[model samples]
Target: MRIINPNLENKLKKFGSDTAHICFNCGTCAAICPLFETSFPRKFMRYIQIGAEDKIMDEKLELFKCLHCGLCTSSCPKGADPGEVMLGLKRFVLDKLRRNQDV
Candidate 1:
């Protein structure tokens, strides 16, 4: 069963993902990303767009793979700045992890 977090998109946006909503899954970001082997920017954006919080959380490693190189951002046709989105996701995940840390 696939779990969905409808608030995920709003959470991401509030976390500073300004261009998260602009992504249309064109795959341009993934194609231009050097870390495509690790699956990022595109995958993360898709998860955010669709509000798949569980999926996004499951792929925490993939989120960290982003180098913030800006290649994906520069090549994005929609000017979504996927690199920045990745950073935002990273921040969100980190905050979640911190809050859930075993004390």
Candidate 2:
């Protein structure tokens, strides 16, 4: 799922390639989100798209807190899905981390 959507970039141009500034931080996502009040999709989305690799790495625990429930997707007017993307990063990083730990 590392495949970046080609049109999605332009589609989300103002939004950014990954995070998309399109995130209004309206809290609709956070409000409807079911993450036990531990989720912050708006900020998370910004960090992901900006290639904030260091920040994302540091915030790994917060990212993993995401349940990827897709409620955010349902309400997102921009169609920007922060939940699944966060999950993807979690999966990718965990897989790599686990592989290294195995050695």
Candidate 3:
């Protein structure tokens, strides 16, 4: 089952540079990331743009691997600010966790 949250892209836009939609999947962000082993920014950006909320939630650990080094943002050809997108993913995960917690 491919669960999709159509609102995810819009929600992410509110949190980050709002340029994620500009990403053409060029792989430049992933290529320049120090943590390329996990394909940080590009993979995560794809998840966001496609509204793959389940995949985004599944890769929470990968999301946290971001060092916020800004290299991804600097290397992005579309000014997508992928570093900020990673931070937004972190925030999204945290919020999801909090919402699922029982008080």
Candidate 4:
């Protein structure tokens, strides 16, 4: 039961995730990742494309797990730059947490 907010992609642009929507979920990023055995980068990319903000927040810790090895970025045929998007997500999550605490 996930609710999609079409504006999430636009909102993420401020945090440096401008190309998330360009990804077509081809799983190349995940295949190239040397870290987690799971979907890793691809899963996060998909979440952003579909505006699954709640899911992204729930798995926010996973963002920190990215190694920024460049493999995922280079392997992506769409030039989506999943590594950069992951970094953006880290910034976005931290900002949200800070804002929540300020309230």
Model 4 CA deviation exceeding 4 Å by range: none
Ten-residue segment with the worst summed lDDT in candidate 4? Answer: 94-103
Q: List clash counts for every candidate, in order.
A: 0, 3, 0, 0
Residues 1-103 of candidate 1: C-alpha lDDT, one tens digit per residue:
7788877867777678868778888888877788757445787888877778888778788678788899998999998889989898889889899999822
- In order, what lDDT does every prediction score? 0.81, 0.61, 0.81, 0.88
Per-residue error at 52 for model 3, in Å? 0.4
lDDT of 3 by residue, 1-103 (tens): 9898888878876565466677889898888888766566898888878889889887787788899999988888888888888888888788778899721
Candidate of highest TM-score: 4
Which residue pairs clash within candidate 1? none
Could you tell me which 10 consecutive residues in candidate 1 have the lowest summed lDDT?
A: 35-44
Root-mean-square deviation (CA) per prediction: 1.9, 7.4, 2.1, 1.9
> Which candidate leads in lDDT?
4
- lDDT of model 4 at position 41: 90
Clashing pairs in 3: none
Off by over 4 Å in 1: none
* Error of model 4, residue 14, in angstroms: 0.8
